[model samples]
Target: MKHLLRKTTAWIAGAVMAGGLMLPALAEADTIKIALAETPSDELAAFFVALERAKANGLDYEWTAFSDEELAIQAVLSGQMDIGFGTPYAAMQRSRAPIRIIFQLSKLKFFPVTTTKYEELEDLDGEPILLHSRGGGTDSIANVIEERLGIEFGERSYVPGSSNRVAALLGGQADATIIDLSNTNKLMRSPEADRFNVLEMFEVEASDEALFANLDWIQNNEEDVQIFVDALLSTYRDMHEDPTIIRRETNPDGPIGQLPEQILGELDGFYGDAVDAGLYSKDGGGRVAANADLEWYSAAGQLEGDPSDLNIEDFWYLAPLDNAMN
Candidate 1:
């Protein structure tokens, strides 16, 4: 009887030990939450690719859809999100929270979409315009327009998404708006296509969406951060080589795939549209480093010193991207 009791107790003790060992794994398995503005534009394709690679690296992730990039950055700054996507310039210079852009996502290639009344940037001097968000990518482009053409938009309105801004224009709620390739393509296919004209705009010195995290949070989660960055570098290489890889690897049941059926079916169309719009590159070697230098010059006012005098090293740490790329 004593021997049998001893054996049973030993089995229970072993089971408890095994369960204890799994506790940390279960805790570590908690989803790493990220946030980004709505719309799966080509600029953000690398992230979807990273998510797929992240799973294989034992990192689980969930994403939150924000109305705009500024809000997404706010989420990360507030600690409500583990990571979020946005241009590194504003967050680095404007935000109160300490955050860093660990990965370079892409560059902005925005064109001005205006009514027939406005043929050029000069025509917009006294006109109202809609943008994706205030103090965001579109706003930055607007600033560039004012600088280049010496014309300032009369009234600036903040509409959150490219689709939302496009709809507002189509519905006659706004006269003109800036938009991305995805919505730009959709607008051309709509009945109001003839109502607006896309103006030829120069490339602005702005980096597109990038992965950002609260500095402290990132330091504590170093391993996970390395894993995420590695996946991003790998995915970026593949996306540059063949943009179609994203569509093929998209989880039909996952968020990227769970996009409205229409959008899903038109994935290739969007990719092609973006490429035609000069929003993406086929070379896959995105101008990550050079663009950062240009961005510094453009955002000179935001920095304390002249861009020519400022050290790029103070703002960017390419070690992460370099490590991942290697």
Candidate 2:
């Protein structure tokens, strides 16, 4: 009886020790760190909606916003963040970062706004144009324009913010500039509205933002990734089916609610414009958008070699998104 009791006590102690060692691993597996390329704005309203869903599903995530996409990319590359927002095509291709895009956040819906001096795209040839940043969406648009129209404009990236770019155009610091949907609407409604003209922008079937993560991290946390993607996919479909869902799901104590009153006031209009413009992809998996991204980026000189030669599988891992969609 003593010998049996001693064996039982030893087994219980070993089991407890093993369980203690597993606790931290379980906790770490549940947490995800995300990085955003830009500050919280109306453009990210749907993401905020999905975040609420993720929380409800027991997925823990924390995010930080960086001033630029480069910084966000670096954060992910350094393992400081598990996921990153932004399309960093060139940097990813050049550095061969082990990042794979899992979700397409938004389509390219930027507009080219200019002072009254430039009435058309051609009119701005050889003139200095304000863009968001080098290798950003606006810069890609400029690249496509230069290729299609056979014209070149002096590119200036002094201001990375869309609102600041609009201000530059209004203040005569720039003759022409490209700004996002919100800034475009604000400029159109401003007192100086008559002074600016929105040129007809060429449409590109490219994504403005994508959710990417390190390939190893994704493989290790496949289940968590799927859960996050599933929540996001459902949120996209819900938003498309009912645009007002954005206002409904917005948490009063959440990030969107915490935004300045003036910015929050524009939320309805911002999402309304997005739905009207077909900004969000109806297909949550982003397969079609992924193909389009290759072509658009390659054409814009953001990617090297022929787009046809590039395999979508190389840059995009659709398993998580695919599982989410189904």
Candidate 3:
């Protein structure tokens, strides 16, 4: 009897030790890895807010920023990252990456600004235009313009940074450039504001950024993904109802907080412009935005085939987002 009791106690102790080891694994499973197409900026303020909320909800996450969208997409494809930022339509169509967009983050709110001499898009005919890069958002915009307006502008790509593009425009390196919302606002407020004019460009009914992940990983981590989407959807709703929520949730120690004071000060204005421009979707988990993305990307030549034939359900996994929304 004494021998049997000793053996039972030993077995119980071993089982407890095994369970202790498994605890860390379970905790680690809750963490998600995210990849950013670019460094954090004022435009991603609400996303940062969602990150904070996710932390509170026990969904820990880490993010890495690549220099460009291509690198970010590659990281996700190789499984080096769990979630990537941009929707690589061409890459997806060609390589058949098992990636599905889970969330539509923002819309294409880009603007074309040029020297005062050019008053409209028509005036840019045959003129050199500074673009973000080949096969990038700015390039897509240029392609759409050429197709719609039946005019071709010489393309010059020196750097991918919007500030660099803005500098090129201000320094007269290029007569016209397409820049982001923040830079557009900065130029409008600059002392040289009168020297430039923001030409009206056609509105792009497409997503500027999205949350995409490997299909297998998404399937395995559906619960965690739902938590993340829930947090993000709530944050978006909060922002739409009260734009000031962005300022209220600004974490001084977070990524956006580390920005230069000049940029930081412009956060309100940047968000204000975004809000006025309807850059964000009110239906956080609806398919309307996804359908629009297909049409816009197809028109821009980013994706092959007709937009009407492409089913958005193939590219998007709406379950997680829909579950979060409800």
Which candidate has the top score in lDDT? 2
* Alpha-carbon TM-score of each model against the true structure: 0.81, 0.88, 0.87
Candidate 1's error at 137, in angstroms? 0.3
Write down the worst ten-residue block by lDDT for model 2.
Answer: 1-10
**Model 1, span 1-326: residue lDDT tens:** 00000111111111123433421111222457788766564445557777778778877667778878878877776566777877656456566545666765655766688777778778888789998776677887787678778788889999877777887887789878888767776787788888888888776534555677766566666777778888777765675566677788887766566667776677667766655555543222234543554454365333444566655544554556656655
Ranking by lDDT: 2, 3, 1
| Cα lDDT, all candidates | 0.65, 0.79, 0.78
TM-score, cand. 2 vs. native: 0.88
The total of clashing pairs for model 2 equals 0
Error of 3 at 37 (Å): 1.1
Task: Using TM-score as the measure, name the better of candidate 1 and candidate 3.
Answer: 3
Model 2 bad stretches (over 4 Å): 1-30
Query: Which residue runs does candidate 1 get wrong by more than 4 Å?
Result: 1-30, 39-46, 94-97, 189-191, 275-304
Error of 2 at 43 (Å): 1.1
For every model in order, what is the number of clashing pairs?
1, 0, 0
